[model samples]
Target: MRILYVITPSRLSGAERMLLRMARVQQRHGDSVRVLSKPLDAFERAAADDGIEMVTGAIGGKLNLRACPTIVEHIQRFAPDVVLTMHSTGTLWGVRAARKAGVPCVALMQAANTRWPYTTAPAAVGCAEFVRQHLIAGGMSPDRVYAIPNGIEPEPYLDDEDRDRARSDLGLTPSDLAVGTLAHFTPRKAHSDLLDAAAIVTRSVPELVLLWAGEGPLETKLRQQAARLGLADRVRFLGYRTDAPRLHRAFDIFALPSLLEGLPLAVLEAMASARPCVVTAVSGNPELVDDGVTGYLVPRRNPQVMAQALIRLATNDEARRTMGLAGRKRIMEMFTLDGLMQRLREVLEREIRRQRGPGG
Candidate 1:
């Protein structure tokens, strides 16, 4: 199968990473995969590093009528079996171009509560069930939307020596309890709530440090909040780490207090690294966390509740280890990279067959 993926991405976020993963898995499975996006950035560089062929085009603005011809030209040149689009802008233009070129198109919804730009595509994939319902509620047909959660390769995250080295490099002692998160420091991610909870957690566990990895628009503001709450010494901002998978080993508990999510890849990475999570109870979070079984789920913006949950995991080492094990078990059973690729392969093949007819 020949697959073409179109995306309009500015940074290396979860969705962009998923796109690369999809291309890699497809290529490994004997499928010809290619990616088309704007001028090279981290996404293109990473894809290139993986030996995937990437094509750059000007996919500007919301509708980008000018880009439609370019997209159609690429579709003609590559002659892919199916085109998969990620993000709103890419979906809008890719769907239009696919229709113009007479090729099958599929859109993957990466966030919750999104307004899908095109309704004519044969099918749309949501990263989680909540995301699918959100698309359906927003006027897309339920039959056209399917939920396919993100998955990860557990081998890279299974290194104990790398974990210990990361802990030592971060000045985190074996006796110290560390709560960590790897998310862009944006408002919707609720880094402020985590800072508030960090202050509260430090009042009880003085050795409790908040290790944050990632940079965004809200980095300076969050740093100020940490300072204002007298957590300047307790909160360590790692800032846009490339080695985040290894850094997961330094954390005693992984937490994400986002206002919303569509099956965050970071949480899954943490679970794959055998760490218990304390994430906000919104969107696809509940689906991943079993609330006291795999991890704790706290309400959004509730720092008090989040802090209490963090303290529970911090104080009891046995319970933390147990939950971490359960979380890894869940990922192995349901969310492995092989499972996600197989499902996506089936979806793309079915769509292509439907578009080409039985004998074509």
Candidate 2:
């Protein structure tokens, strides 16, 4: 199938990363795939590096009123069988442009919480079931919306050799229990909450270390919070990294105290790495984690609860190992890249066939 993915790119955030992954997978399967973004951000550059075509323009929230003709022209030139749009504000214009070009369109509701995009597209997709419901509530038909969770190409994270090499490169001791988080330093991700929890968890386990591996608008504030909590020495802030999969391997546990999520890819990567996770109860997080079974889940924005959960995993080595193994099992069983691609393949093929009518 010929597919074109459209997204607004100011950063290599999770939604843009999902577009890149989809482009890569579709291209690998002999599908002609290309990416369209507002500006040439790091995410677009990464897609180009992977040999996927990246098309950039001024088609964005501010330019939507005037950018329709240009977007239609691009779709005309590419002649895609389908166009998939991400980001809520961009969906209506993208779908309209594709329709003008006489092509079927699919909009992906990338965030867990959305108030629009449902009424914008003929079909919609999302990482979490809750997100799909959100889209439906905004007035989309039930049959037209799909709850397709994010997935991982686990080869990058599951490399045993890479784990040993990454540990050596980072100067991590063999017995050091490293807890890592892959999120932008932002209030929604609740980095401050994690820092507050870390302060309490570290008091019981002095050797434990925490890695905050992303840069965002809240970096300075979060740094101050960590310092104020006296966790500056134990917590290391590694700015935005493209090598998160390899980095996940260096950690024994992954903790995310997010205010909301739509099956975050970072969490999936952590599970694929067979590392235990402790995430806030929000969106699709609970769907992926079995609470006390695979990993721990704490109430969102509660540092004390997060701290207790972290301490529970830290104090028990066997529990951590068991949870990690269970996480990996869950990933293999339900959330691999191949599985996601297969599901999408079915969806796209069915849509194409439907558009073609019964005779074709």
Candidate 3:
């Protein structure tokens, strides 16, 4: 199968990484895959490193309707079996391009950051079931939306030695509690709330160390919050990291206090690495975390509740181990990277056939 992915990404983050994984899997399966992206130095470099073919384009937000012709031209040139759009802007033009080029188009909704994409695409794949419902509630047909959760490769994280090395680098001792968060330091991701919870959690557990890995516009603000809360020494911002699975192995607990999410890849990677998560009970987070079984789910923006949950896991070694093991088991059983690709493959093939019609 030939799949053409379109996106207008400005950062090399979770969504971009997941798209790269999808392209890699297709290439490995003797399938042809090409990407159309707005030129981002970091994201372009990452795609190149993966040996994924990418063509830079001017495709972007609502105002960039001029990109539709270029996208259509590319579609004509590549002549893919299907065009899979990534998120909003990608969907906006991709769906239009596919329609013009007379091919099937499926948009992957990372989040309901933009609702217009749902109305435009013939079929949409949501990163989480929550996202599917969100689109359906906005009046998209039920049959046209699919809930395909993000997944990860568990083998790479199993028994990783990077854990000890990371601990050592952070000046952490065996007795210390290392809390890790891998997310873009953005407002919606609520890194500010995490800092507040960290301050509260630290009052009881002073041995707590935080490893925040990711850089964004909000990084400086989050750093200020950490210092303001007297957590300057405790929090270590690792900056943007591409080696996510390895970094996930370095933490005892993985926490993300996002205001909303569409099955965050960080949480999936953390679970695959056998780390208990303390994430905000928003969007698809509740679906992944079994609340005391796999991990604890705290209310959005509630630093007090988040801190309480973190304190519970930090104080009990057995609880942490049990939850971590359960999380990993959940990932292995339902969220393997192979499982995601298979599901996506089904969607892509089905969409292509649908576009071709019964006798084509």
Candidate 4:
């Protein structure tokens, strides 16, 4: 199968990382996959390292009619069996271009809260059941929307030696408990709420430290906030780590207090590393965390509640270890990369057969 993926990414977030994983897995399975995206630094390097073919171009604004012809031209050249788009802008332009070029288009729905503009595509793929229901509720055909959760390879995250080295590099002592998170420093991610929770939790558990990885526009502001709250010594902002999975080893508990999410890959990665998560109760979060089983789920923007949960895991080594093991077991059973790719193949094949109609 020849698959063309279109995306416009400003940074390497969850959705972008999933795209890379999807492409690499598909390529390994003997599918010819190509990506068309803006030449962002991390994305370009990672895509090249994975040996995925890439075409760099600007997507312009959301309603950029001028970019449509360029996309159509690429569609003509690639002659893809199917075109899969990442989010809103990609779906809008990609569906338009694919329709113009007479190719099947599938939009990968990454968020549950945000509504997409175009619904004319033949099919849409959602990362979770919530997203699929959201699409259907938004007037999309039920048959057109398919639910396929995000998946990852469990091997890369299973390195204990690398984990120890990462912890040592971060200047973490054996006595210190680290509450870590890997997310872009964005308002929706609610980094401030996490900071607030850290403040509360640290008062009781002074050995607790914050290991925040990933970079974004909110870095300076968050740094200042940490200082003003007298948490400068406790919080370590490691910007945009390429070794994020290894860093998961450094964490006693993984935290994400996002106001919104669509099955965050960060949480999945943390679980794969056998680290218990304390994430906000929002879309796709409950689906992953079994609430006090795999991990705890706190309400969004509630520092008090989030702090209490974090403190519980931080203080109890046995509970953390138990939850972490359960989390890893859950991921291995349901959310492996091979499982996701198999579902993706089924979706693509089903769409292709529908497009061909009666054995064409």
Candidate 5:
């Protein structure tokens, strides 16, 4: 099968990273996959490495009518079996272009909290059921939306030697109760909430240290916030890490106090690494982390409740180990990369077959 992916990414975050992984898998299965996106160096490099063609173009602003013709040209040239549009700009213009070129299009809605222009999209695949419901509520037909939660390859169970080495590399002492979070330092990610929670938790669990990874616009502001919250020494702002597995290995516990998410790949990576997660009960997080079973689920933007969860886990070695083991088991059994991709391929084929009705 030939697939064309349309997206305009400013950075290589969760959605872009997941999409690239999908592309790599498709290419491995001997399918022709091409991507139409803005010139993002990380994305381009990964695409080139995966043997996927990168079609660069500008898809800017809210209403991208100007980009539709460019997209149409790519559609006509590539002649893909289906076009999968991601992000708002891509879907808005890509759907139009796909229709113009007489090709099937499916919008990949990766978030549920933020509203995008998905109402007019013919067919769409949401990263989680929350996102699928978000689309249905936004006027898209329920029949047209499919939920295929994001997934990642489960990491092999780490030995004590591996965790120690990873921790030592990150300047973390084995004695420290390291709580790591991997996300862009943005308002939506709510890193401030984590910092505030860290302040409260450090009072109780002095050995606690917060490992905040990923880079974004709010870096400088977050650093200052850490200082003001009296958590400067307790928090490590490791900027822009591509080494997710190493980071996950180093973490005794993973936390994402974000206000929203659409099946965050960071949380999945942490779980796949056999680490327990503490995330806000919003969007797809609850679906992934089974509350008290795999990890704790606190209310959004509540530092006190988040801090309580962190403190509870930090003091209990048995709970952490049990939850971590359970989390990894869940990832392997339910959220493997291969399983999710098969679902995605099914959706693309289903749409293609529909477009070519009555056995064509």
Candidate 6:
């Protein structure tokens, strides 16, 4: 099978990271997979390391015509069995280009709360059923939409020695109740809310520290907010670190207080790392974290509720351990990379076979 993935980013984000993983898996399974994206960055370099052919194409301001011909040329040259478009804004141009080249296109709707104006396409794939239903309700045929969630490849957990090494490298002591979050500094991610919740947690648990990873436009503003709330010491804004999984191992607990999410990969990584989780109740988070079972789910954007939940996990070692074990079990059971890639390959192969039919 031949697959072409279309994404708008040159930098590494959750979606791009997923794309890189998927490309490597599909390539491993004897599928010829490549990517059509902007300039080569760290994300593209990672994809290239995975043997995914990268074609440079830039799309600016949603409907940039600069890359239209390049996209059309790639489609005509490669003649892929499936073209999977990631991100809603880029889907229209990608779908149209694929249609013009007489190829099948699948749009991946990755957002949780934002209702993007989707374009008509052969099929639409969403990371969560919530986004799938929203797309279908907005005039997309039910038969043309699928709910294929995000996934990751999990390895064995780092031993206590390695965990300690990571902590030492990050300047975290074993005594600190470290709660970390890996998310971009955006309003949708609600980093300020997490900071506020951390302040509340500090009042109760003075040994607690919060690590906020990833960078975005709101970094300076968030730093100011942290200082204003007197949380500058407890909250560490550890810019965008590529070694996120290692960071996950260093945390005693993971928190994601996002206002909205479409099954965050960071939460999945935290679960895979056997760390207890506390995430806001929104989008596919409830489906992932089994609230009181695998992890705690507080109300979205409510720092006080989040703080209370964090206290529960931080103070109670037994509860934290139990929930963390449960979360790891759930990730191994439901969100492994092999299972997700198999489903994706099934979708691509089925579409290709149907498109070819049984005739000449």
lDDT of 6 at 143: 76
The positional error of residue 180 in candidate 3, measured at the CA in angstroms, is: 0.3
- Listed in order, each prediction's TM-score against the native is 0.97, 0.95, 0.97, 0.97, 0.97, 0.95
Model 5, range 289-348, lDDT digits (tens) per residue? 999989999999899999999999999999999999999889989999999999998988
lDDT of each: 0.87, 0.83, 0.87, 0.88, 0.87, 0.82
Stronger candidate by lDDT (4 vs 5): 4
Largest lDDT belongs to which candidate? 4
Each model's backbone clash number: 0, 0, 0, 0, 0, 0
Q: Which candidate would rank higher by TM-score, 2 or 5?
A: 5
Please write out the lDDT profile of model 1 over residues 1-360, one tens digit for every residue.
889888888788999888888888889889998898977578777888888889899985685678889899999999988999988888889999998898888998888756758455668888889888888888888877788888998887776677677898999887788899999988899999988898888888988989999999999998888889998888898988878677888998999999989899999989988899999999988888889998999999999999999999989999999999999999999888899888988887777787768786
lDDT of 2 by residue, 1-360 (tens): 889887766678888887778778888899998787788567766887888898888788744686677789889889888888888656867888887887888888767666665467778787879888877777778898898888888777776567878876666788777899999877789888888888888889877888878998998887787788887777888887888877988898999999989899988999888889999999889889889888998999899999898889988999988998899889988998889889988888877676556764
Give one digit per residue, the lDDT tens place, for model 6 in 24-97.
88888788887888774786678767777888667533667765566788888888988888775457678878
Give a tens-digit lDDT track for model 3, residues 1-360. Answer: 888999988688878989998899889999999999988998889899999999998887778868899999899999898999886777888999899898898999887666786677889999889989999988899988899998887787777666788677767788778899988878899999988998999889998999988888998888888899999999988987767776777688999999988898888888878899999888889888889898899999899999999999999989888999999999999998899999999988887788789975
Candidate 3: list runs displaced more than 4 Å. Answer: none
Candidate 2's displacement at residue 352, Å, is 2.7
Model 4 pairs whose backbones collide: none
Relative to the unseen true structure, what is the Cα RMSD of model 6?
1.8
Over 4 Å off, model 4: none
Candidates in order: C-alpha RMSD to true structure:
1.3, 1.7, 1.2, 1.2, 1.4, 1.8
Please list all clashing residue pairs in model 6, or write none if there are none. none
Worst window of 10 by summed lDDT in candidate 4: 113-122
